[model samples]
Target: MIVERLIIADNQPLTAYAVEALSRSVAQEIHIEDLEIAYAQNKTQLNNLLRDGKKTAVVVDYTMFDFTNQENFTIVCDLYQNTSCWLLLSEELTPNFLRYVVYQTQNVGVAYKDASLDSMREALHYVMTGVRYISQQATQILLQKAAEAENRRDELTHTEREILKAIALGKTTKEIAADRFSSVHTINSHRKNIFRKLGVNCVHDAIKYALRAGLVDESEFFI
Candidate 1:
């Protein structure tokens, strides 16, 4: 495969090394297109160049122009809309952030900036072949972060967790209110706050989240 690579990285040595590691056919056609730093000069033209270019693998840095920022991500959104196959060169990547990047494109791959030659080579090779390359570091970090988030989940207020458990157990608002020795209005207010904190819209969705987060166990319910 010709495997056209459009790099938006500032580190020429790293990018050049990556280009060299690609399939032999691709090794010869390393095009920087427009440098990522060019966005600092004129983002409009930079986005235009990216948007107008042919559909190919885009290798860009996570630190390139504050790419995670909403304003900068708008440009990234536009770029992926007009391109395909993104390989992100990152520094210290988080699971949530990596997940966001993966959602933005097809066949997404992330490689740490300080990755060894083998890691870079493997990531690029997998990306060029239309495969997802999530490095060992990224996966391990994601798992560790998930555990940390689970611990944070335990920090919810006692009342909030009681309301959440009741909701998960399929109690109606009035039923929950009666059980808590409170009025329906108070229960509803708590329910609203629960939804807000859980980042969910409906009871079913909240229940699903609660199950996933280990906040509630269905087996514990009494008949």
Candidate 2:
């Protein structure tokens, strides 16, 4: 689990210095060869470093990096199988983005930029060891989202839940009726009941609830 290279891909100078200092300390303690430390101010430099296909560990503040989107960052990470990343998040990143990144990548660890030195060191150790590490702040956001989704699922009846899933899949009332061998009126009534139970007033909200509740996969919902 020796990290041959450590890339600090953050634009903020002070933050990068602090992470570099902490990383160097951990590397020294672990005897990780005083790994080559590189600074990537932008994506091109980051890509070039990763293209070397070495056992590299990266600590990046994605919010400040030039990635066009979270998916763009994911794409870059996916490109280098020999590389692992530790996300240095800021408080401004949204809960959904946090969840998306945590779920989307296997070789990425997450910690806030303001995290304690110990937490940062632990995250570095985990990422370099090919393990996942999520900070307390990010874990709270994910747990809260999971609780809300569970509550939404618990509030709906079986029929209402099925109807909501159908709606999320873009099925019309008529189509749902046809699939269930029921009248369109019955499907429409179930849709209304779903809205009432979920405290939503419209189909779009019900569909959103279904997506969040895990009744429908995100890809299915989008399609």
In order of appearance, the predictions have TM-scores of 0.59, 0.74
What is the C-alpha lDDT profile of model 1 across 1-223, one tens digit per residue? 2234444543455554545445343433343333222212234444565665555555656565444473465456554643555567777665657655554544567788788877877776665644667888877776675566466465668898889888888789999999999999998998888776654557875686688877777576433
What are the Cα lDDT values of the candidates? 0.62, 0.78
Candidate 1 Cα lDDT to native: 0.62
The candidate maximizing TM-score is 2
Model 2 misplaced regions, further than 4 Å:
154-160, 165-174, 177-223
Residue 49 shift from truth in candidate 2, angstroms: 0.9
- Could you tell me how far off, in angstroms, the CA of residue 149 lies in candidate 2 after the best superposition? 1.4
lDDT of 1 at 138: 79
16-58 in candidate 2: lDDT tens per residue? Answer: 8987888788877777875788999999999888887778888
Clashes of 2: 0
